[model samples]
Target: MERTVGMSRPELIQVADTVARDKGIDREEVFDAMEQAIQKAGRSKYGYEHDIRARIDRKSGEIRLARYLEVVDEVEDELTQVTVAQARRKNPEAEVGDYLVDPLPPIDFGRIAAQTAKQVIVQKVRDAERERQYNEFRDRLGEIANGLVKRVEFGNVIVDLGRAEALLRRDEVIPREAFRVGDRVRAYIADVRQETRGPQIFLSRTHEQFMARLFAQEVPEIYDGIIEIKGVARDPGSRAKMAVFSNDHAIDPVGACVGMRGSRVQAVVAELQGEKIDIIQWSQDPATFVVNALAPAEVTKVILDEEKHRMEIVVPDDQLSLAIGRRGQNVRLAYKLTGWDIDILTEATESERRQEEVRARTRAFIEALDVDDVIAHLLVTEGFYDVEDVAFVDLAELTQIEGFDDDVAAELQNRARSFVEERNARDESRRVALGVSDDLARVSGLGGASLVALGERGVLTLDDLGDLASDELCEIVPSLSESEASEIIMAARAHWFDGEDTAGDSDAGNDDAQTGSDDAGDSRTDD
Candidate 1:
């Protein structure tokens, strides 16, 4: 039996080497897995409670099996641990905590045990293989990968990338695109995840970075870092836009990306199934960049609200359809490329809207300040939209307006202040009628109008105000800034902490009274 086992030892090492090479795992790991499988078989043949272990000699491939017994002052588990006296009987000078190894004879292979060991080895090798794949691909994110289509199931393509496999889901593929088995495919490695089954790699053909990467491969200047891709927005399979910038002054970024007679761009378009691409020059100024992004259509005017990140684009009536593209694709791409909320308007529409705004502001001033249409129009022309602007504005500003002397400016400011006072008084009465508490009204940043708004929303007490988040308060009162609302809420919560401090003080006083009574009782007992 020993001669037969020795003869098979070299074959075991050869099998381990083959499995390690085929599965792309370390040979040492394979040996460790084999040893664990042998140890499991040995435990089954011996008693399950025994601590059996197995080792393989690296050079000679000889197998060794042993049972480990620990020396202890008391033996709780008789099979795995022995008393110090019993351990010393086997080998004198054996001390507590020493592990004694007992050699065991090799057992003949049984069919069931062999199958169990095979399963264990297979499972361990598979787990090691998955770990290897996950470690190799996790760092390769945001890169382009080329592979063959292994199979397609329900519109999702499974790509075989030689060393690993990746999935291209249906939504991630360009519209109207299809792939068949064994077809060559290229995609961007969007994500990689380690799951229970194995490592999963997700690929995308319609990702914005896919276009950027393709351009880099086509343009030498881009690959060499002379030109940089600033942004990309895609309506996949129909139209897309890319913004590129060149560090070299002499090199035209747009012309370089377009290539000689559009050869380079054409190659990328072909790979994407003829998706149309518009390459635009990038700019540091937002207005200039937006203008460039909305190419092939002239921009007559651009009104930007920097605080809101919104842009009102005015184009010629004839170019409205072109600027908006087929179903608003052009302006949509421009919005994504520039990170702006865009509203496209025709030149006629913009002009009409501006006139309407001026008329509206004039009407507002006439009603609020008790002024005539002529004065209101003049105020609107001077860019004073509301009574608050007239009330809080510099007296010099009003005097600077044409046809406005010091007396006229002074009268306007007085009326504006009176009107504001009356509005506040009215709002205060309404707030009181709504049952809003005075404590809530006294919150430092809470104005009469804000109190009325909060009361109408059923936030009628200090506790109610304290329970609200800053964003909820802003929703109820739009005029209050976020910081102001936060301050008001903090002030409302101050009373809650004050109550806690009062309770703590009361507890301390009661403890002192109890201690004084106990001292008096002790003194009386001494007397």
Candidate 2:
């Protein structure tokens, strides 16, 4: 039987190699694990008090356990309590306190102990393999890799990643992109996690970097560094925005991506399942860049508020529908790409633009005023229409604006004072008969045009304004629809009534009459 143990060594070696191969562990690792487990079991089933060591002979299929003892002058522990005379009896040449390594016969561990040892060995081997796999794949994150679809489990796809299986979760797979069993697929190695079951390899194709990688693969210009993608934003399966720049001035970045008759972009679009791709030329100037971002729609102006990182984009009246896109998609993509909040408006909606232009022209006429075309545009943003409008503005309102310090604001206040005094003098002379104040004409904050409109409607004085019904004002002002007309009338009446109330407390007897008029006004305004 002892001879047979040595002769059948090749069969045992084959068994170890097969087990190691199946478990993806080194055969030496398995043998080492087995030796450790056997030594531990020997100490557990026998005694730790007895010194023990174990070794497995590779060629003999034999496991040897040896118990050792020191030849001591006096015995202390009974398990290894051999005296010098006792140790000399066994080894014959032992001296005092000399270690004696005595080989023991192969001891049979019962079925339960043997099974436990096997389980520990197998678990250790699996743990070693798992750690090795985890380390190998953990370094591969963000790299593109090719693998075969091995199987589908739960909702995740199990891919054979050469040395291990990678899981492609349902969410990680691109929309409408399918994988068949045994079919080769390319994906990005997103992550690797070590778990008790094994190392988990994660693969992804829907990541934003995946799109860049795909472009790098298909577009030689991008790969060769002739064209650079500056920025990209995507609403997956619907729309995508890419800003591209070119190293070669002659090469149009958008045209290069579109290819001949939309071939290149079509390929990428096909991969993304008909997702709309908008390719825009990258510009150093933010204003021009924004206009490029909102293409197929002409922009009248792009006003950048750099402090807020926002854009007030104005398009022509006819181009509003196109610039806003179907449900605001065009401007939305532009906003996302530029990382700015875009407020879109039409040129027609900017009612003060013409007046702003007149103010800029008037600045050339006014000496000591250093205003340019851009400042004129800024004035419109500040709601200053024409030079006349500026003539009526208060110093307080001017001081509120940025860069309009107390000194500069005071200068504007002085300039308006001359025009204001002249107009006020003329109106004060006519105050009793015409019932008008020249100060009203010089007030820029309120609507000077609305005052003129009220005057044209036979509102000659404050008393006339107080007497006019709000519904009648609504009917006269074509621009002021019913609700807007009522608001204006009530405001005018309140201004007139406030003056009347301040004149006398004895007018308290007319309180009921004032209340009746107010009720009538409220009824008309509510309509």
Put down candidate 2 lDDT per residue, 321-348, tens digits, no spaces.
8998888888888888877788888887
Tell me how many clashing residue pairs each candidate has: 0, 0
Instruction: Give the clashing residue pairs of candidate 2, or none.
Output: none
Tell me the tens digit of each residue's lDDT in model 1 across 292-410. 99998899999987866888999999999999888899999999999988888999999999999999998888888888999999998888877889999999999999999999999
Give the Cα lDDT of each candidate.
0.91, 0.73
TM per prediction? 0.85, 0.56
Clashes of 1: 0
Root-mean-square deviation per candidate: 3.9, 20.0
Error of 1 at 388 (Å): 2.5
lDDT of 1 at 453: 91
lDDT of 1 at 347: 96
